[model samples]
Target chain A: MVKPIIEVFDLTAAYGDFVLLDKVTFDVRRGEVFVILGGSGCGKSTLMKHLIGLLRPAAGRILIDGGDINNASGQERADLLKKFGVMYQSGALFGSLTLEENVMLPMEEFTKLPPEARRLVARMKLSLVGLERFSGHFPSEVSGGMQKRAAIARAMALDPEVLFLDEPSAGLDPVTSAGLDELILRLNKNLGVTFVIVSHELASIYAVADRVIMLDQTKKGILAEGAPGELRDHDSNPFVHAFFHRETAEVAG
Target chain B: MDFNQKTGCLKLGARLDAGEVSALWSAVGGRVRHVDASPLETCDGAGLALIWYVQKGGATVTGLRPEIAALLRPFDHLPVDPADAPPRDNSLFGQLGRAASQIWNDTRDQVAFIGEFTVTALRCAVSPGQVRWGDMWVIAQRAGVDALIVAGMVSLLTGMIMAFQSSVPLKQFGVDIFVVNLVALAILRELGPIMTAVVLAGRSGSAFAAEIGTMKVNEEIDALVTMGIEPMRFLVVPRVLAGFLVTPVLTVYANFLGVAGGFFVMMALGFPFMALWNQLVSAVGVTDVMTGTIKSFVFGILVAGVGCLRGLQTGTGASAVGVSTTRAVVSGIFLIVLVDAVFAAIFYTIQW
Candidate 1:
């Protein structure tokens, strides 16, 4: 079996007095699409934040290839950040820069490539996301879906080993969301990049995820974790069953 | 399996793309000197560039298919073109047009905000219960009263320096006592209010812009709008009222410190304390104190108004907060000086 790229050992995440995720554990394997699934308020986003080192876990540790991310120094964290990329829910594109410039920002910061090479790579990344035409457009000038695509392009600028996306399809229409799902699958398969996405959309989960971990709000831990088909077919947890089947609250926990 | 040591050949992978090029090429290194293109599945410019780099390190390329060799030819060396041109707006006329439009928009927004604020101010005046007394007290303590010590120190030093400088020339004429009157009139009539406004512009004015700009960025302002709360009344009124009430009091405090500073300097110049006090009293009338108080009140409105206006006009993103904070300080100071000049002219014409 391939070694896991990311390991979470009894990770506990909290904001002050409120604990969102408690003692959750999981592993995301290299070159596989790992999806975090949960109902609203289940701390799926909080767990994602912890994995990306945005929030230091209140307890336990997160290891990225045997290095403890929670306890790493500032420079170590920055080095770790270059190993993975993040696409926030709102796209979080720098509003002041055009889409091409935004994609070039990471390259300029991290790579020794000359300006022309950086621009070419930026254009290539934009093309990968099907946003090459919108390279010169400001984030505000584009549609929401284009912004999300541009953000993903920026995230991939450094050719990160892992990509973390937080609800990439939240504000997109179904067609656009499906397009993004297809793009994710293409990148994952063609480029052999690992994806760890936090999403509750069953369609997206079924389309791109090789494996999924379902977090339960009441339990504040993993309710189920396995291949999507296996979990949907046989997982006995009511939340998991209800979620996969899109059942009404009558059978939901 | 791809790299055969005996044959000195490393076969490329199916997806020889940009991201994989560096890692795969490094793995092959210059040790395996021959690259076998027989099993090469795909490649791009970046992949070919890496192969060319390895070939330059004394590695040889052999068993290459014709099509793949043609694909690799263009990237054999770095392109000799100039760097990508940096994006910019270079047209002077276009910049001027944009600046004019921005100024027009800003003025219109400011006028509309002032109208909304004045309506809220009228409501607060008529029915004070609509104003949140608790928020007012907190803001007053944070933005006004807490600033007293620094304001006092600065005003004191300013008055002492003014007295020392003026007394040097007066002492040559043996008229050092007149320094007391000069300091008193200056502090009570102009310097006190102006200095107080300058300090507040840097302190509470920027603070107001930053705090509200952050809220605007975080969509708290949108949340307030959705909740059917008037942000102008809910947020701006208490702050404006706090500024209006506290500024004049702070100016009064500053005026007293300035007089004390002047008295200290007079004593060092060998003038009696009572003589300096008598001169100050004879020189400064009720009109001087009133003018400073009224000017401070106006300056207070300008500071709070411009600060909140800049915040409310904040655009999106992290840099927007910083831009609003800077605009608040610049415009707040400019408006204060302009209003003071207008006040000076009116007072001069009326002989107040």
Candidate 2:
């Protein structure tokens, strides 16, 4: 069996008094597109945060590659984080900097590349995301689609092995969202980078997801996990069936 | 053949899986030039990774059992790279240079902002209708009337303290009547304006910074920018005009309350009301009142300018708002004192 790239061992996420995810265990295999699907407020974003090491889990462990991420010190966790790229939902671009400078930020911090080389790499990453012309513009000056593309370019600046995206299709129109989906497929095929995405949009999920884990807010745990088509067709749970097929009766009740 | 000598060969234990690594490493001294796995029983990916790290520097392994080698074959070609270098420039000189450059940028931005504010104010002064009278009235009530009690109380206490401090020495020489002259001259000339400036800086100046800083963080400033309305004209001008129109009045009001406080002390010291009033009227001249009022008017400009500048310069985040507020109060107080000193020197030279 191929070794998984990321391992979540009985992880529980909590905020002081409220438990978000309870004893969740999962594994993301190498080179696979893994989607985390859930209704709103079901701890999807919280799980993403815990996976990216932005927030520590309340219990259990998160192992990235082969290193124990939760047990690692600051420097060790930073080294582990270099293996993964993350694009936040808001795009999280520095409002004061140009897109080119924003892409160069990670390279400047993490690599010893010279100024010209850093600029060249930044331009290349921007071009990869179809943002070559908008490199000189600030984040606020660009369209929302352009901003998200620039943010993705910034995340890919270091050529990480794993890419984690939090709701890449959120707030984007259907046409723009389809374009982003195509870009993600192209990148995944060309670069062979593993992806762990948290999303709710059914079309984007079915189009891109190799497998998905459905989280339930009321259940406070995963309701189903499998290939999206299989889960939609074969899963006996009414909630999973309703969520994937877009039926409103069982879910709304 | 014993494994201790003749090229640092490590003899593998019976169980070389993940659970036995610590004890095995302690026994093996952490550096193995060669591995002899003849006695090996079991191994996993973790055990293979451990051996790879131990033998990372071009070590040779002999006598590895075929099963153990098979277990390690999957990870045999793991990439070897050098440790990454840490980030740079944490030394004191680097920090000092960064701070100096930041201060230089701040000063330049402040100068440019002052120019912009001056142009806006002058334009509004020429076309009075450009100013929003409603906002000006609202800000005047906030920055002036609401601030009256705190300003009045501080100035009054300051006057009483000044009078009481002067009375002991004057009464010794049978000159208790002169306390009113000293209090009136000093309060009207310097203390009233300077003290009122400090109070305004603490009260309205910091409030201005906080209000605008919150707006900046909430993106309301950006919304205004997109709406094509000049924020300086719409937001800042009212505050500045309110400061200019209200500070002098506050200073004058503070001056009288201060004089009355001195009267309270003087009357307690057995000086008659008419005599104290007569001394005060004779001692405080038109020039003294004008000097204090004019100084206070300039102080108002300083407070409003610094407050607005710091607020507009705010960066993003929760801490950025706090930092802007602190910078506003600090720079407001600093510029007030510095301007007062420059005025004192100019007046001394002119014998005002």
Candidate 3:
């Protein structure tokens, strides 16, 4: 079995009195595209935030590469943070910077590469996402899909081990979303980078996810976990089945 | 990672990530003609980039596993030429030309905005029902009532400083009691209106720009336009009218506070209250007060007008609102000082 790169044990996420996920546990293997799925208001985003150390868990621990994220502080926390990158839902590129400059930002901060080398690496990363031609364009000058692609290039700037993507296809058309999924798959297979994605788009999920964990609002925990195809065909939880099938569950009168 | 210069063969390690690859590139300086990936177990994006960089520099790579070969395959067809790189154009003439064009474009936009504002304002005057009195009242409270304490404090300080500075020299001439006349005339004619407008420029002007600029960025202004709602009528008119109405009143309050501050100075210097009051009343005529009030009205228009104009002219992206707010404050103050000079010239010509 592949070694797990991330381990979440008995994790509880909440906002004050409003508990979202209660003692949820999961593990993501190295170099696989792992997705967290759920319906609206199911705490999927909250769980992703907690995993990325944006929010502290109410209970339990998150171990990333065998280091406790919650317990690490100062340089230790910064070192842990260098191991992963996050792409936000809105393609939150720094608007003032050109695409290449945005990609070069992390490398400039974290590495001692010369200016020319940093520029070359930034261009190469943009080329990987097919955005080399638009490296000089600002975020507002490009279309939404291109912005997302540029954002992915920025996220891959330092070649982090894990890339956490929050709703990579939220506002894109189906074709653009599929292109993004293809990029994700290519990156995962070629570069062997692990991806932990948060998404509810079934088409995107089926296309990129090697494994998935679906959170439920009512359950306040993971309702199902498996490969997308297996879960669609065989998962017995009604909510899971309904979600995978895109059916409105009929309530018992 | 290691490179043998004699054999022209570069050897990579088990983990070839960004940090290691960067160090290796700085060392070898892309000098290799051959790469042996036989010992390479894993390579990341930057590692792939290094290989591509070497390949682009005419290196031959051998012994790559099938999976790694496939990863390197996609980057093969991409153009290695730098001809398509974006132009920076940072020469002195280039910068001057860009700045010139930007200023030209901003001036044009400001002219167009002023025309639109004038038309809308006239329309609102013709049909008062089209005006948004509710928003006007709300803006009035925010731009006027909320600003009183700061405005009063500033005015008081200015009055005290002016009286103290003039009294020192006037006392040398044994006419220090004339400080009352100096403070009253200056506060009523120049300081009160100008100081109040400056405060409004910093506080309410920036707020107006930020609010409207945020809406412009979020497409709320576009939404209004699509709905056939005139943003000028719906958004700009109320704020401008509020400023127009509120500034003169605030100036009145500021003038009172400034004179009171002068009176405080005079009282401390052993002048009786009634004597200072009688001197102030005799020195400051209704015309002096009217001139400041009229200037405040015009200054009010300039401040709010420039703010709304900058907001409506906001560009896209995260920094757009910040840029607009800054432009509003700067242009507001600039126009205030410019028009105040014009008023000063007019008053001097007319000898009013």
Best by lDDT: 3
Residue pairs with backbone overlap in model 3:
none
Query: Which runs in model 3 stand beyond 4 Å of their true positions?
Result: A251-253, B1-15, B33-39, B61-67, B83-97
Model 1 misplaced stretches (Cα beyond 4 Å)? A9-25, A55-62, A65-80, A217-220, A247-250, B1-89, B123-129
What are the runs in model 2 whose C-alpha is more than 4 Å off?
A249-252, B1-186, B189-191, B198-210, B213-352
Native contact recovery (fnat) for each candidate is: 0.05, 0.00, 0.47
lDDT of 1: 0.84
Per-residue error at B313 for model 2, in Å? Answer: 10
TM-score of each prediction: 0.83, 0.59, 0.94
lDDT of 3 by residue, B218-305 (tens): 9999999999999999999999999999999999999999999999998998999999988888887888988999999999998998
Superpose all Cα atoms of candidate 3 onto the true structure and report the RMSD in Å to 1 decimal: 2.3
Which candidate ranks first by TM-score, i.e. highest? 3
Docking class of 2: incorrect
Cα lDDT of model 2 overall?
Answer: 0.83
Residue pairs clashing in model 1 are none
**Model 2 clash pairs?**
none
